[model samples]
Target: MHISHTSEDDNLKRLLSFSAIAIKSSCGEFDIYGEKDTDVRGKELVFERTRYVYNDALEYFEDNFLSQITSLGISLIPESDEDATI
Candidate 1:
């Protein structure tokens, strides 16, 4: 899964305050959490099932989520520190 900023503003203040989408996949549940960007830093998951479910859920999210955000005129800014695994 990928997460990125979607605005022209790049300052840490602005970027940190922006809202971000968080996805959580469990054995029998797929959930999304939207919160301020700063809240996501260093967050980690320790469940084995989460990794498996995430892999499946992300395939669906990539196919469906990108178009939805693009249609809304949101431009995704890639994370400079990491490469997309997918």
Candidate 2:
């Protein structure tokens, strides 16, 4: 018997799906911080943590989840710290 393999296999699809979910979750957290962040220093800390979560998820997806697929691209994360605002 033989098997056929493709880039968008089941495991790879699951990985991409999970990454997308995690990134969305981080975005939600960023929004919540925007609402609840009152103090200047506290807000800065919140923003830094948000940045860490966003960038960490983005990098993890790039490093681990993206090597298998060729045509698919997720333009999920903001490209710059300034754009990361809001």
Number of colliding residue pairs in each model: 0, 0
lDDT digits (tens) for residues 1-86 of candidate 2: 02277744665445544544554443322332344332232334333334444445544433453322211212323367547674
lDDT of 2 at 60: 44
State the lDDT of candidate 1 residue by residue for 1-86, as single tens digits.
34376453344323222212232211111212324332222122212223334455534443444444332222123344225543
Candidate 2 lDDT for residue 56? 58
Candidate 1 deviant stretches above 4 angstroms? 1-56, 74-86
Stretch of 10 with least lDDT, candidate 1 = 23-32
- Using TM-score as the measure, the top candidate is 2
TM-scores for the candidates: 0.21, 0.27
